[model samples]
Target: MASADDVQRLFLQALVSRRVVTKSLARILLKKCVEAVKAAKEDLDIRIPDNDDSVNTFVINLNASLDKLDLEIVPFVDGLTGNQVYVLANRKGDEVAQVASDYSPAELAYFKVLAEMIITAPNSSYCLSSMAALRETQSLKATFTKTHGERVLDTFVARGWLYKSKSGRYSLTTRSTVELQTYITNTFPNDILHCTVCHEMVFRGIRCYTRNCEGVLHNHCYAAYKRARQTCPVCDTPWNGDSEGKLKKVGEGAFVEGQDKHARARRRVDDEDEDEDETPKQEEAPSRLRHRRRGRGKLRPKGR
Candidate 1:
């Protein structure tokens, strides 16, 4: 049964011990200590009034005043001590203490295990077996079963850290890949098609269609000499059994003499057939009967 004066004395002693007795800081610390005492008294089954609007308002103002005071104090401390100033510094001591007070020992251990799994997982892609193996290596009792693993994975998925592909394989996102690449370069190199003969990047090549003659040539070089002459560049045989003569560029009327003679002969035969088709058929009239009458007169004389 400590009196309020004893409590106030102890609170002032704590502030003096910590060397934090600035006016605004003292007010904020006293308010926090009063709240802590209230919580402790309530733990002893003591009933306090449910409403304390004045205290709540005072706490809100105290927090704002403390923030401004910290902002003013940090620069002075940094300038005097040569310490770097960090803007918006995380003063999470109270938050961490509150969370720690709320968590049981078993719950804290489970949370640690969950955090370790998240950190050690490859690209944060994991399974029950992997977490079990990790725990076994650390000599910790694994409290997670397959269902628990599924729940952990589901949480990561909901947070967009993990994804399941159509093939049922779990994978990390592109953002994760960029983060992991900082540790090591993970890429494979490859080569494009290069001509074996010329040792150049083969943009286009001519393949010999002849069996057992796997000849490849650059398009420009093959056309300039070997192809323009209408010969197999490798074998020197006339392509399509045509004479070893230069091929006329397409749209150029440069037929060979032999080809022209054969074409002209064909055209002459066609013209003769057309003439015969155009000729009309002639009809002969019957000979007059004068010869027959002379024969009849001579026969009449013989009869007389």
Candidate 2:
């Protein structure tokens, strides 16, 4: 048993905390609505409104009521099928427009490539290797370079805009995910292309962010592509291509027999630097240590 007041309170809680009903978040709210009713002893006017769609309608109605107060429920995007989510944001703020104006042209273009990579990444990985970014940089050859790209990437890594894996792959961080979701969805409305794997009409899918390859695969097909071949089937350009190529060479349309399983599975050694240090120290005498020992001899005379 739940009251109108209790249902209203739950709506307020949702808007306060999450602000948006992402697919996964929608389930959580639906569960909460149902559970709250069962826990309440007094019945006023509500029980967990049947299902997610119903719950969503309830939320929308609540937002609609706030129209008297200048607040509204807005969908993040239009024309994409399936469950539509409504997010709460103030009309006065206009955050997305303000943020877009803040970026320089180069940085703005970077996000476009990033958004494309995110949609096309296997498992919605939202990650791209540095080598891929370099290709984007090269396209801006008049304004950017490989050195400049690495600096920009490292800066992003430091600023929490991106996560830098030890092997040098860069992925959008949670902060970037939060800030750019609406922007990416709204901006790339027309970059539609086909999935190389299934050869289906894809609104959005995985794009192998290679310099020349730029192969696109359906979201589902990306995993199959990896399992079948680490390299892009069409271009044979590798993911993290600069580092590994035993399986296929760049610009070749053929598969090399053996692929590096670890890189393909992304089971990279996070402690590569530590392991390298230990190996070299164990295998070779420490010249630095010998230098320190020799330099310490002058210090003994002061004690004497």
Candidate 3:
């Protein structure tokens, strides 16, 4: 019987042989295998295990050998939903069989069980269900929130893994999809509406209305135009007539009859008081004017 050390040595030798496997390579291989398993599960609407038991055992043992390695192995016979295992096994029988043929009996058995478990019980407790759903870039943020309950969507935006459209939908960039897989897997957020000119969050803006035209200029950019030139710099559409630019006022009709009546009454009382005060002043002014005229007439006559 092979000792644990012997098994570990042989496994390492196989991995580092002509290929000279590095940690990165191992991660890539694991990712590919996981992806393949996920794909098979999705194609058949079930989980299928990797068919090489030897490989599975080696991976398990290899993970044990390295303190830093935290590999998760979904046991073929355990933790799967009944439907997942059944569907996976039924669809991937040939592939599993072929993989079993290439490996040792122990490895073959391990992989065969993995394949069966994946097919028969994909969502079972024993297996890690692959992310089978293909998420759109726009919906990633919301989905990410729903799935992980974390606010990692901002990180994606910060890293440019996601971009906002003028219409407020989030879409993934090509580089974003490639570099932010881990973040995406956690959760993606809805796309934000960013001003194309300023790259700032664009709420309802004048320049971002047309779906075909994603031109999102900042309010400052729009203000740069003269009154006659108040049109979209991108499309030359009039900003005044743009539906997005129309500001919707909230709670506009807050002042009703009672408030208006009170205000009108107070103004009326003030006007009446002012009129009363003015009448007395006007009467006094006439009398004073008559007296001043008489005095001036007397002085002038005497001088003449």
Candidate 4:
């Protein structure tokens, strides 16, 4: 464990040695790096986190380190989103760039508005109907037509910003969710707060449509609740089942290479979880086989 700490501790060191350190967790870890730097106080050459034990622990891609002139890393916590986002800030303390320089003004505006609408909409986490997104997008401005909005949304899905279902429902990818979290939380505080049914931060949920019921419940949780109680678990309001069949699941298409980066990342995290389970199962499988072989050997002796 201590040897592992040597590598992880170096990763902690590299993060702080940058322009600036942000995020509470990162800030706490920065102290260790500051101490290390002060002790060394000679030369520091940033290398990949997996280089060696003295500087190795977790693997951080060396390519991710961008070369920007006179820039510093700033940890930004937007007070609303519970996550920290790092930005390369200049002397003025403003973000150096908004990511790729190729995005047109129209594209940037369209992306933000669409992200806000999808994440802030009621029943968002369960899945916002694509039709609903179009309606909201059209309302962004007089000139923004539903057709244009649809194209923008399609572009977002293709670029891995959102997940589009075959049946035309949309869900936020982890990228969009993290980026637009502050907007979603601030815009729809009541909806995004603890689910009324389970008191959890599950915004992809359905609402109690019973005339001012205002109760929000997770889709799966509501499924069980509706089966047993036929009423809102948060409030005693009668449940309004999916009268319009909007909750029906639409099978999503398989992901392909060079598309849906967020999907790829999500699948990776899920794969990691499965791999953890497989390790124990693999050991158990071999042990079972060995036990069976021993039993056969005993049977052979009895035959003799």
Give the candidate number with the greatest lDDT: 2
State the local distance difference test value for candidate 3: 0.32
lDDT of each: 0.34, 0.48, 0.32, 0.44
Kindly list the per-residue Cα lDDT of model 4 for residues 254-291, writing each as its tens digit.
Answer: 12222333423443454355445333444567644332
lDDT of 2 by residue, 65-184 (tens): 777654555554211222345556444324444353444556545554444454444433434566665666754424876787677666566654566666555654433433444443
Off by over 4 Å in 2: 11-25, 37-41, 62-170, 173-218, 221-304
TM-score of each: 0.19, 0.35, 0.18, 0.37
Pick out the ten consecutive residues of candidate 1 with the lowest summed lDDT: 295-304
Instruction: Please give the TM-score that candidate 2 achieves against the real structure.
Output: 0.35
Residues 24-45, candidate 1, lDDT per residue (tens digit)?
A: 4444555666666666554443
Best by TM-score: 4
lDDT of 2 at 283: 43
Stretches off by above 4 angstroms in model 4 are 1-94, 100-102, 119-155, 188-194, 197-203, 223-231, 237-304
Candidate no. 4 TM-score: 0.37
Residue 123 displacement (Å), model 2:
18
Better of 1 and 3 by TM-score: 1
Candidate 1's displacement at residue 34, Å, is 45
Return the candidate ranking by TM-score, descending.
Answer: 4, 2, 1, 3
Give the backbone clash total of model 1.
0
